[model samples]
Target: MKISELFYSIQGEGKRAGMPSFFIRTNYCNLRCMFKSGNLCDTSYTSWHPDDDKNLGETSIESISDKYREFLCKDIVITGGEPTMYADELLLLCKKLKKVNKDSFITIETNGTFIGEFINYTDLISLSPKLKSSVPFDTPQKKMHDKSRINLKVLRKYNSLYKAGKLNIQWKFVFTSGEDIKEIKSLQSEIRFKNENVFLMPEGVSEKDLKKTRPETVKACLENNYNYTDRLHILIWGNKRGV
Candidate 1:
């Protein structure tokens, strides 16, 4: 698999929040999104703009899975840049991780732009569809990202999987303003995902920004019946990587 970084950390969001988990952040992204606040997507290092410092490269599934054995965590989170970008490799990698710990809860964090059969074997699928708030300021990139980011077909596929008892799913959305609630409501009407499975997270890359935005996010979640989750890693270790 083409991995950016693999490490163990407490899961910072979703149904598995607070659980000690292994994080496999894969390299490359289909969309070039940055927060409206000008903070680049938190995983930019794992995105199309690869960080020279990390120097992400390919490694065998057995090698990466061995790290999980070392960490001894029960949950494995395969996140991105966008994991579905490497669906074939991920399928092979997940199978190896399962060999290491069959009981492990394997979670995949996705942008919901790509639908893959690989998701069938996962324990949890956290779908974060890019919102208008994620559109970048650069004109051409913004146009491209806006054009390709939200794929209703993929979302419906995930919704169908959940309703059919084939998938355990969470629809995660990032928000910066109370106005964003209207956007979520509109999407909820379309997908009809379980309300509790819809998680609303504030758009922030640092502890201070996250704390500042928490109050309004709490109100929005309360009124909308959406689960509110903060990025615990930021609170515990700022926005530094390799946690």
Candidate 2:
């Protein structure tokens, strides 16, 4: 796999927030996310400029599993850049993790642009479909990012899998403003996913910024009957990497 950083830390976002877990952050992303607040993607080293980390190189799936075994953690989160970009390797990694311990929970966080066999091995799919607000203005990637950010067909497949009990899924959206709710509603209407599975998170990497957006976020969640998730990692460690 094209690996970036591996660490044992608490699950920082979505349904498993605060749970002790191991992280396998894959390098390279399909999208370059620049939020409406003018903050570049929080983990830009893995996306916007992957080479920023000279040590960002390949590692075997065996080594990844060994590290998880060392932690003996109940959960392992495979995040990105875009973990789904390495679909076959991700499948192998998930298989190895299950082989090590069948009961260990596995979560794969992705931008929802790719769907693959790896979904079968994962316990939960943390699917964050990027909103238009994530498009970086005036960048060469803006067109590509805007065009590739959302895939309704892929989203529908995930929803169908969840409906058939093949795997669990959470539809998480990073909101920049209440106007973002319109896009979310439109997607939910087309996807026909259950509202309960929807999670709304404010777009911020700082505690203060998150605090600034919390009220509107909470209100939006309440109004739409969606769940609210805070970036616990950000609150606990500012915007630093490796939790």
Candidate 3:
């Protein structure tokens, strides 16, 4: 499979926060998001630019397991430029990881577009759906028409996972503008899951960028009884990859 980078780090978000885990960040993303200033960017790696061919490296499942065994972590996180982009490979990889350590916990961070394919193998799933504000300003005219439709399909997949006894899934919406928050609330009404499983993550590549969205939003989530997730990797690495 095409992998961007892999390393051992604490899980910085979702239900497995602060756990010592191995992160496998795959390369390539299907979604190109527009930043607040109207710039187009890939949502794969938080720091990658849309125009840059930042394909770092690639490795097979055996190599991944070998590296993880050397690193000695009990948990593994499969993330990517949309990890679901390679569901078949990932399903096989997860099976290998499970055999390596039967008690190990496996989590997959996804953009929520391809849940149906990976549900059985995934132990924990973190679903982050792009909001309207995440649309790239310079999106090619050809791709714009399908982008909106795909986003809704992704949300429907997320709701389906929850209804299928997969409540361990966490819905994380990256909030940019206040309007993003409003949209997320509307999504909550649509999905109608328990508030505790919902999380609001500020859409930022660094701690400073995240703070620009304001701590008040976290307070707002608390006031309204939703979970707030801080991107610990961003806070510590400042948009750096392979943490």
Clashes of each: 0, 0, 2
Better of 1 and 2 by TM-score: 2
Tell me each candidate's TM-score: 0.96, 0.97, 0.86
- What lDDT tens digits, residue by residue, belong to model 2 across residues 209-238? 999998999999999899999999999999
Q: Model 1 over residues 103-214: C-alpha lDDT tens digits?
A: 9889999999887778866999899998888888865788889999889888999999899999999988887887678877777889887788889898899988898788
Which residues of candidate 2, in runs, are more than 4 Å off?
52-54
Error of 3 at 145 (Å): 8.1
Query: Tens-digit lDDT track for model 3 on 24-69?
Result: 8887777766667543442445333432355545688899888889
TM for candidate 1 is: 0.96
Global lDDT scores for all candidate models: 0.85, 0.90, 0.73
How would the candidate models be sorted by lDDT, starting from the highest?
2, 1, 3
Assess the local accuracy of residue 7 in candidate 1 as a C-alpha lDDT between 0 and 100: 84
Poorest 10 consecutive residues of model 3 by lDDT? Answer: 42-51
lDDT of 1: 0.85
